[model samples]
Target: MSMDTRNLLVELFVEELPPKALKKIGDAFAQTLYATLQSQGLLEKDSMLTPFASPRRLGVHITNVADQADDKQVSQKLMPVSVGLDANGKATPALLKKLNALGADESAVANLKRESDGKAEALFFHSVVQGATLAEGLQKALEDTLVKLPIPKVMTYQLADGWDTVNFVRPAHGLIALYGNDIIPVSVLGLKAGTTTHGHRFEAGLDPVFIRHADTYAEQLVKEGAVIAGFAERRAEIVRQLQEAAANAGDNLKPIDDEALLDEVTGLVERPNVVIGQFEETFLDVPQECLILTMKANQKYFPLLDADGKLTNKFLIVSNIRPADASAVIGGNERVVRPRLADAKFFFDQDRKKKLESRVEGLAKVVYHNKLGTQGERIERVRAIAKAIAAKLGVDAKQVDSAAQLAKADLLTDMVGEFPELQGIMGRYYALHDGLPADVADAIEDHYKPRFAGDELPRNAVGTVVALADKLETLVGLFSIGQVPTGDKDPFALRRHALGVIRMLVEGKLAIGIDELIAAAEQPFGKITAEHRDALLNFIFDRLANTLREQGYSAQEIDAVLALRPQRLADVAERLAAVRAFAALPEAESLAAANKRVANILKKVEGEVAAKVDTSLLKEDAEAALNNTLSTVKPQADAAFDRGDYTASLQALAALKTPVDAFFDGVMVNADDTALRNNRLGLLATLHAAMNRVADISRLAS
Candidate 1:
């Protein structure tokens, strides 16, 4: 370490921060501070940054930060020489005015240099700019960084004086700014720099932890404050403690893996102590998902599960303080959670008393969308769409109709009203309780499958049909009303709905075409414009192109296959595979180029070009040779295409490379003789049609 440089530390101690936004705010604080300092030349190339964030504080430690930045040689451009100086080469009023504006006087004119600025010569002023002191630079960086922090929401609170107020993520109580062992004297949010900060409201060994040095902040806080100062470190410790507690709880018992819950709990405490608590076994009769959701969402508890992944009555509590005997802590947590679990059980039991069908009428009272009527009307559309899809897929239509009718019934249940995320899940349970068919029950839940990317699709054929119908209806209905997604503002998640439709058709390998499905979905909406239908189709294809790209296919491959707008999305993968295989052949490049040329030639003809070529007009040997090659190869390619061997079909075109090159090299496609030109155009048209059956191979041309 240089004698002139030392590590710097800055911390803002405040009341509890929003746990969901704590990590993001901490990272932004450190990164922006480092960037601002680096831009001012106050940091060395080797300087390092370490961020610290807990429930109560956000801090950063930076190494090799200088007390003052280095001086810089700066150049300033004045007006053009013609405007700033007379012909006698003496100072003019404009020159003196410019010099004075730059904190200079007429004396500076003698030292000013003349330089050419591209088109004209200009007067330039040069000076050595003094560096900024640590105090000045740190103050600016602190204020700038605080403003840039991604605060979820700000709270306005009065300062100690009771007159002045400040807005911050939380009420700021203290601030610490240290350069090595000396205070740098920076302030923010009505708080002055200090070395003392409180930790672990009740468990701290010291009422105010004294940080002695910049580099010792974390260690000092841990020793005297009874707090873990690093967010990641605290989270890892909590994980370790939870694992140990779960292992000791019982055989094959493990806490549920929920990263979001873990992070939220980590932000809720400065010091973590994991303890196990259990509710009555009677609560287990309710669905485990309900129990787990209540524990994690309502109480931020980690529910433990047995070997078969079934929820046990036991759960883990991440308390902020640890006492010698934890029995009371465990008992208190148990007492607090019993009422929550009892409420869940009561909702489940009450919901099942009346059949799901009874609530179907209540859906009429719920407005789905102002333009689309009520949930009851939407259910009828979904039923119509689902029945059509079920018929196309050769599945039982009666079960699909029943499932669609009851799918949204759970939305009226008390449990679903409290937890909207459990809508489809509660429907499944209620359907099973009402003695619906097992496939119908499963389909009720599975219809909402593949809710997000990489999420699983519907489990059964019945579920698959309903899911496709549901997503399609949403897409067609919203699109009809012109609620299309533009840029990143997909308020309706139309992109996700479109991708879901693509996944079902492509992944499920259904025989249904995208157009046919959209048409079926639109049928229930009465009359939809051709414009809306076309717009929706384009949207789906655009999403499919992106999906194919994410799956690792190149843009050219996807464009070539999607160019034809293949109705059956399931055929896209096969076509792209064929295009890739055909691209690898040694003759692929030449053939692709020839195909491009052929398309351009066919596009220029004024009238329709026939695929049938007149052999009598083939006066050139190259044209005749090409014509003979197509006769022999076309049948073989057609046979392969007929049986779904796209790769073999595309590979058959390899033989035409030599003949195609010869025809394009020697033949005159647009001859002065009209008869000859039309015959050659017909030949190219035939070639274009055969080559592009799988994909537009011309797109593969470099």
Candidate 2:
């Protein structure tokens, strides 16, 4: 290390931060401080930073920070020579005024540099600017960094004086700013720089952990404060303890893998102590999901699961303090959680007393939307759409109708009212308990499948039909009222709904056409305008194009296939595959360019250009040769297309590359002779139709 530079440390000790936002805020605080200091030349080129975040504090240690920045040389452009100087080449009044305003004088005119400022010669002022001292620079950096933090919410609290107040994420009690062993003297959130900070509220060996040097902050806090002092270190320790505890519980047992919950728990404790607790096994009669969610969401516990992925009666608690005997801690946590589990069991038992059908009538009282009427009306629309889809797929309509009718019935149940996320799940359980058919019961739950990106789709044919119908009704109904998604603001998740529709049609390989399905969904709405229908169709295709891109298809491939607006989304994957294969052929480039030229030529004709070519008008040998080639190749390509061999169909067009080049090279498409021009247009029209059956190959042109 250089004698002139030393590592710097800054710490802000505050009350407990919001666990979910601590990681993000800590990262931003450290990074922004480093960036601001670097911009001011207060740091050496090789400087490195280590960020620290815990429940009670945020800090950073930076190496090779300088006490003062180096002097900088700067050049300032003045007014044009004509405006600032006289023809005598002496300093004019205007020039003297500019020089005086820049802390210069007429005596320095001889030292002024002259350079061309774009269009004219202009005088430039040059000076050596003094660097910033560590105290002022550090103060500015602290203030700027605090303002840029992503605080979820701010609390206004009174300072010690009881008259002044400040807003911060949490009430700050102390601040530490150290450059080597000396205090750099920076302050924030109404707190002045100091070397003492409190650690664990009750377990600290020292009332105030006294930091001696910038390099010894973490070690001192751990030794005297009874705190881990680093967010990552503390989290890793928690993970290790959780794993060890789960292993000791039983073989092949593991805590639920939820990174979000782990982070929240880590933020809740400065020193973590993992302990195991259990509930009565009889409470397991309720669904595992309900029990697991109650433990994790309500109490912030990690529920253990066995090798078969079934929930066990055991759960793990991450306490803030470690004691010699932990039986009391375990007993206290288990006692606190018993009533929560009892409430869940009670809701489950009460919900099953009346069949799901009984709850269907209560939905009429729940408003779906001001314009769309109630949940009861929406269910009718879903049923109609589902039945229509079933009819097209040659499936049993009765099952689909029953499933769609009861899908939203769980919303009124006690369990679902307590946890909205369990809506579809509870419906399936109640339906089965009511002795409904297996497929129908499954459909009631699966209708909400594929809830997010990469989520699984409906599990069976019945589920698939209802899911499509449900998503489609949501899309058309919202679109009819013009509640479309704009930019990143998708309050209704219309984009997700659209993608779900695409997934079932494409992934499920359903025979239903997208346009036909949209029409069927719209039928229940009664008299939707043609403009709305077209708008909804365009929206669906737009979503499909985006999805195809995410799946690694190139923009050209997606555009070419989607441009045709293929009604059957199931055929889109095959068409894209064919386009990709066709693009690889040596002749693909020439044919694509030729196809583009042909489209442009046909677009210019005043009237409709018939596809019927007149062979007698084919005067050029190139045109006649092209005509003969098409007759031999068209039937083969058409046969492949008819049988759904898109790759074969596209590959068959490769033979026309040579003849197409010749025709475009030698033929006069727009001849002065009207008869000849129309005949050539007719030929190009026929060629365009033949080439575009799979995709518009012209889009592949660079």
Candidate 3:
């Protein structure tokens, strides 16, 4: 098991590649090579494979490839086609069909057999096939390897490119494929193999590099004043230079996570160098988010920080080349960033003075959709529903009203107008400027905090109220507008909004009735078609079902409780959680047997017979006793519900288990007499009424 240190050279040279695609394409190229080599069984030992790329080229060098495969037996099996044919001692047409299917030339097959099933078998014969050389085998295997390679984006130049499409990300200018010291000719896309590789476009004495092996690939490119390698190396070099420049000037710099910036910086340089630039104090007046976005989003410059956590006037700038005079680059960078910050500062001041309330009227002018009415109309519906949600939560009604009114007002603000990402943040700033209560202002901002899944939930009661109102209006409006979500498309993100409403109620411990509020919000959809109403209800509930699963509730658990009530989403969540908890108790397994027995009896007396029992007709002692106890417990259970003591209500219902089991064992529910049937049904009806206070007990899983 000797390690063969054979050098493998591979390169794809083309037009300058965008930095964004280089790292990804380089990774994909390396993976394809490893996967292909494994499939061909060429590299049996552990190997070192490294990928390198620049604006115009991507290459790889593999170190520990197997010198050669183990020599073993090559079994070849092919019988004369005439051997398995008809009884006649002849070469049949069936034999011809078999040969054609195997891609053997018809003339190549000898029409004779030696010994098969005596005389008839004797007509057929077989021949041995020779195996080819390992190098030839390797060449065939590697030739088809290019088809499996995936390039991120490609562009066509002259003749063969990566794929035969309209155009690729960049043209395949030249390629270098070498196996050890020898050239390996394998045609990929349309390009053939050679040892010639190009160097830095600007240098290298006007001649392309002629590298015999991959080990020298990187070294040759470096000598030509080009760094054709990894993103990490380039990134580290840039940071090192930037920090050095910053430290000399008594300013500390730190690297931030900006993958897009890192890539653009990679493409901006063959060799990266850095400098620090500063601006005036007036720019700090803008919001932290605005200033960060201005620097990171616009200019791709790293920000400088002071000893305090506050931002400084300086920024770190990375340049492709180290200019002889560094001040020229620094001066150029400050000029670019200053205008960006000035625009942000101007947008901040203009937005601050304009009150949120005055802009509320302009929302109606903005169309949420041509069919779904104006933003103003949507706000009116949200306002009406917010009051309902607030009342359910026992929140301050005045604050709820104010939040709904101003929530969408920031849509017209200059800050929100310029930065769509700052919608709710602007609302909070504007709310404070208007001298509104702190609770309402915080709600206006926090309502949209969790704009996506796994995002933070509302922080305050007011935010929760507005969030519910906003989701309900959307569910009702979309259903009313006949634009319900389907198998794929949910253009409105209605599902996220609905899940947000459900999650807030159950997880946030808010007690609210979903159906009642949704129906109230549906008031504005009077013009809705009947089709829309039915479809919307199903879509809304389906989204709720999905949300329930996401929150870790099982299908059986949800279905067990959902059948009882449709109005209270939060209450239903509580009931399911309690049921699951109760089910976990050791005694509950025994309790389930009694429940199953009760369920079986109830299932028998479903439709024909009434459920309420007449005390006079309770002929059996157990039936009579159970009926009396239910009468006593009914008033207490009703009282527990009024006080929101659900746990006590559940305990009260469990009291019926002994008597229910006794009644089933003693009396016959289906008797011959019509009078007896009616009497038993009446008794079961009374028992069901008591259980209904807990849940639709019939719907609870056995």
Candidate 4:
């Protein structure tokens, strides 16, 4: 009635799984399990389920699943009831056998209620269905679902001949499938699955032990000195161990916030082993970012700090094996990582010897995009775009040009070559080594801002200019080649580029239209032309609306701005903010209602003649007042538009409220007098022009 309250444990033992595969596999397993349980009619909130993966195995734990499925009542249709029978009511020979079988089969149908035809020759019956146990259903589902589970890249070893052909990311060594204390015997990919699983590779290899129950699995690993499952638990243990080690060393471990490292270290070990390792303090002279990158990337170590809040010469290493002597383990890890630091320090020293500017000549030989040009050519274009954008944004023109010139110089650096992740990072270091200005170094570093959603933006104007240049170049290049992001595949990250452009404008408060900037950036591209003009504009404009709406504007609001074809991004944002704010204004509500009436009146004169408002034929006091109101608001709206204060313009347009409402209610917009009707159409044209100054009010709903 509530929950199964039974724990389900499934562990698929393998030789080892890659760290990247762990997340995907674990997610799929949890999703499949939850989907099965939910379909089996269990309430998810009352149930708990989770999955964990490590280098050796994938394990799942589910608690309090509804033990039994909710009772099911089904109704079955019997062969249309009249298709096989005649009006005479006697069972035909063909139908007699079908009826006799149904009558004797009690399991197929618990009860059958027959309805007789007027001729009494035929009988139709509805049968009752018997409920089945959820446990039995789950077992059957597991049987059918295994082959469908996603293991995108498979590695096969040590099974039957066809086992090598068996599709899995890796070889399956063992399986532990349990519900409460019972084993669900499921054989997948030639592995005889059971409820019991062993802890750690050594114990599983040495003793061939089996776990008999779900509740015993976690503690069994504990007895084997294993912290086998949850990452949260593993991370907590690492922190506790690191804190104690830090206390002993008279330093505190300042966290570097490396989630990727934490996850990798989590899977690399079955047990929590925190080892404090050290290198020579001279290595600390290397840039902290470079040092951290080296330690985390190559050595898989976390650095520590002195209580003074600076990186210490020490680092903390999380090991899979806890040695019999703690010092011996710490010494071994320290020995391994010191050599990595040595190599990094050597690279740093060797790189600094040659000025970064001297390295500029080497990028000419490296290709950026085959169709586009060499990385050298790209650097030139970027410098141009940056200079232009910088000039527009009132940035120091010299700094912008210098930063753009040096931005791609790091691509040829040995350090960047060794660590592909350090492209922009290496540039900053190189710029400083070359004696370039801080603004130049900053632009090199900050140009990659808003790399992902919610990432930090550039703090300096020089960086902002370079960022915009970089984004526009990529967007224009990709669109020129007709390879825009189609349905989620943004190989070039064009969506990200567009969003970066938006962030640049919104965050920098830069008052330039995205389309104008994109067009200006594309002017240097020889491939873009007038024939595909609308296509290019649509591509950029549509993305802006999509990105803006994602930041949470209503669909109508998004359409309303694009309708205005704004030239400044600030104008678009201002208009949108104004429209949303205006939607709640009392005059806005009345104006929308009046416009709705105006639209309805226009619908009747559709096939007759175009109506234009005539100044001389204005007989209705309502019409005169409405025309006066438009005249007064027109100049105010124009002034507001000029200053980029759309809110004021929108408020000014609200002046037409009373007259517009009264004109629609008291006068027929279309009359037998076509001149008067035409005059009214002219009035609407004026209103449309007025509304267009702020937004397309026609797009606004009543």
TM per prediction: 0.97, 0.96, 0.74, 0.86
User: Over the stretch 215-309, how does candidate 4's per-residue lDDT look in tens digits?
Assistant: 77766666652546755566677777767877766645575667778777776777877877788888888877778888888878888765666
Which residue pairs overlap in candidate 1's backbone? none
Q: Which is superior by lDDT, 1 or 2?
A: 2
Candidate 1 positional error at 399, Å: 1.2
Q: Tens-digit lDDT track for model 1 on 14-61?
A: 899999888888889899999998888889999999988998999899
Q: Candidate 3 on 1-702: residue-level lDDT in tens?
A: 224447576777767877766777666666677656655455655677787767777667776555454444432234543444456644457656665675554564454434545434333324443333335444554454444446565554556443454345676677777777777666654667788877655545325777746677777676654554565577677767766765765645454546677777776566676777888987886766778767877787877665555677777887765657989888989888888888988887888787889999999999987887899988988888888778777899999989999998998987777788888887987798789989999999887756888888888988988888888788888777667777889898877877787678667866556656666677766645667766766665777777778879878666656656556665766677666765555545444565555567767764754656667787889988788888877778778766766556655666676777788789887888888777876777666666665455444445
| Residue-by-residue lDDT tens digits, candidate 2, 151-222 | 999999999999998999999998999999999878788888989888898789897888999999999888
Ranked by lDDT, top first: 2, 1, 4, 3
* Clash number for candidate 1: 0
Task: Go through the candidates in order and give each one's C-alpha lDDT.
Answer: 0.91, 0.92, 0.70, 0.73
**Model 2 score (lDDT):** 0.92
Best TM-score among the predictions, by candidate number: 1
lDDT of 1: 0.91
Candidate 4 stretches with Cα past 4 Å from truth are 1-6, 41-45, 50-52, 64-73, 76-82, 89-138, 148-152, 158-165, 202-206, 243-253, 305-310, 530-553, 571-573, 596-614, 666-679
